[model samples]
Target chain A: MSAVAALSYLVASVLFMSGLKMLSSPKTARKGNISASLGMLIAIVVTLTDEKILDYTFILAGLLTGSAVGVWFALRVQMTAMPQLVGVLNGFGGGASALVAFAEYIRISGDASLSVWTGDAPLDVLITLVLSILIGTVTIVGSMIASAKLHGVMRSAPILYPFQKQTNAAILVAAIVLGVLFVFDPSRWYLLVIIAGLAAILGVTSVIPIGGADMPVVISLMNSYSGLAGAMTGFVLSNNVLIISGTLVGTSGIILTNIMCKAMNRSLANVLFAGVGAEYDPSVQAVEQRTVIRYTPEDAATILESAQSVIIVPGYGLAVAQAQHALQELVNILTAKGMLVRYAIHPVAGRMPGHMNVLLAEANAPYDILMEMDQINDDFQNTDVALVIGANDVVNPAARYKKDSPLYGMPILNVDHARTVMVCKRSLNPGFAGEDNELFYNEKTMMVFGDAKETVTKLVQLMKS
Target chain B: MTEGLMISIYIFVLAAFVGVEVISKVPPLLHTPLMSGSNAISGITLVGSLIAAGEGHGGLSVILGFIAVVLATVNVVGGFLVTDRMLKMFKKEPQKKDQRA
Candidate 1:
């Protein structure tokens, strides 16, 4: 490699690493992203300039088009869809890497001189070719499945057969046997096709057994799979840049997948094979003796006006209403009155981690005031009022005690612990996990029936008046 | 083919457009969970990097492969850690039946 090319790669790598590191914290994630992209740009430019390939025009055109689309997506994609977009982009990356590997294999295989120099004219070339093809093909299929699941095209509930475990095992055995055969005799091109088919089936089956609630974790796991596939293909081609980049992606994906599994308090094996949280028990006896207290916007305003301390607990409802900005306005109003105001954010409040924080931050809510469940749950005792906006499962009391409930053992924000719990919701419907919320019937709880944005806006008006 | 490249670009652009449309429609209450869930997708980069590394040949390739492995590892580890920490906050215990007022 030329010294200049090496220097450029080094710089790009450093940029990528630093950008990834900064991405861990939400505050600096945007900057981290920019830095990483810049590194990638440098790498691409340097690679193109240093290579002897005569097709500069196509390369430049591709770069321009890709960048334009990337920029537009970056500018336009909503924060909520960011995950799906990320998934698709990841799939693209895998697809791109796989294509490069295939191209390399094809180039080498067709050239007699290159094949002779590399080794056994057909065998060595074929081995590399098959490995690249397998890995790249798998990455493409697996990522697509993951993206689909995330986007909700497929049912989020686990699809289980009577002998789910045995079926998965059988598929695995077949794929392994085929892989082994291909390794021994590289000429059997059909073996590679079989392996790809099996891998694709594995991807689908692996994700099929996971529930919607566990999608974030599943997506993370598939992401790791895609990366590993990429790195393996890089090895097949003996490309230093591809190998390094692919390995970085694979390891990070696995670690993230593990983190997601742990977030759901599940093991990787359980996530893959246990089919937990998939069956929604509709027969669980909900306590019907308890009475629900209803409050109009004006009534809610009165409660807020008298409260010495108020905490706003946000959930998926708040996100649905896009009320972060209005909610921030309410917080400002309450805080100005010397009321202790804070946001109680559950870990899995929306559909993913830190979903509330991101939305609130977009509305310019002070990061300091956005409290995690552990940080603010205890404070609910001293809190005169807890305003729940569009939250259900996270605040549902059943998650704590109802053993049959899908969310049983799942930690919840203690909004129910507050002296006066006011929930702003459109209806008494259960949450995504499809379980009724007992917190609604608490004596201290009052339902402020309306859209979260409208309710908050009305409450603000009432407070001002 | 260059056509594939063009198609990929179009897909992303469409994806972004769809993303904005959906976010606008989602209730504020769902924001937290949605964001957390979506962030999980970022983990895909780790997978890509790892596969790329495994294809490397000798010397600098090996070193680069190792680096990719480490970076991907960190991303996966840190991401799950944060996610788990978040999920723990939602598991609530049942209150005593007799304590109900």
Candidate 2:
């Protein structure tokens, strides 16, 4: 309400804009974050100073406790668990917003003077409150399920039952019906509570049916919903900063979701409604195999030493095997030999977007040599060897030809185009797509069965000799 | 619609546009940190939480308000700290970990 408060919010919005712009570039991202964080601190301080407080006890308690726990999670969580951590944080944001909106509703309804529906207190508040509670509660439970799946607390695969889609639709309808009842009689607080309960349950059911391959999209979509929930809370509180920042996050999430979907050449509807890669029929025969030539680390080293250029294709296997450091050392040794080595990264190479880039960066791999799917796809033709490390579906040749394959039409790294391809995998098990990789049977491809880290380590040792 | 409602709508529309513009330029590689960063921003519920906590309503409102405050604060702090951790790994210079040097 004060001019200074408004001015600070304006400054905060500007800071948020600049911060997001800086995030687009790697070099200025840290400064961008610090600037945004400073803005947040200013916004919070300004709100506290303006709002009449009976006591700062609860505020201070929340701050200290939350910050301590937050610092612990941030510092203690492994890089491999980043997706799950992000998922959990998104859930926390939604739950917080939902609670805040409902609390505001309770406070207003208790105030006899301000609870009027005609003049000062209108239907708008009711609508916003219903929306905030609905979206926020759903996002919270949905994100929790997502995080659980990612953490292996539950199966990463989509857990399906009879008429799962129909059940989800029914829950959504019930929540909406309850929301309608609350909009008319805002004082009927129990109706709102029932709606929140239904929305929360809806969240769990909706996300539970989405398979692992689609997790990145589902998580990002939930992030968008949390943003929308925050926006609804901003409306209820009539806070400009909350509204602007919430909108920013919500829009950003939608854009991210779209990008992830586009990268996989899948539609958002297809991703949400039809869970791909979740149901793998083991009954399908993988009998197209001709010959799988086996090789040892010594042979791998010899091939690498003879090659003029090599492309390293990494995947979830690298993360599971913790082979990033060993692979980096191998790249280092290969670099020393005057051999050209570049990394060809798939869009969905790891568990999520940017996963491969950050994981490899943690291993101190030079970022310049790491190329995106489109950036280095063409060069695979001229490369002497493609070292497929703990990778499968991304480099699977079946995507190009087999119409009946689950991976059909999905763009993949053309590792088979290279003169020779060496695959390091544990067994002949299928990938997330639940289809056998024909590239594993390619004449130019050699199956090097072992843990990626140990195999890469052995290759490093052999290179030394 | 009421004048107050109209103002809220106007603010909401303008903010949504601003948000889209701000987020449009972020690159693909930074998507993870970007998601984390925006998640922190959405924790803007902290403002509402502060108000709810100070309102000193009935027992339920106060309790709910306190829980909300804690959760929002967790979101704000956890989201930013984790994002910062991730971004720190993406430095121009790599760390030296000489295992078998």
Number of the top lDDT candidate: 2
Q: What is the fraction of true interface contacts found in candidate 1? A: 0.03
Reference contacts preserved by each model: 0.03, 0.73
CAPRI tier for the interface of model 1: incorrect
Which lDDT tens digits does candidate 2 get at residues A142-223?
A: 9999999888999878777889889989988888888888787776778888989999899888988788878889888988
Best by DockQ: 2
lDDT scores in order: 0.58, 0.83
Q: Chain A TM-score, candidate 2?
A: 0.95
Error of 2 at A459 (Å): 1.1
Question: After best superposition, candidate 1 residue A102: deviation in angstroms?
Answer: 2.8
Top TM-score hit = 2
Q: Write down the lDDT that model 1 would get.
A: 0.58
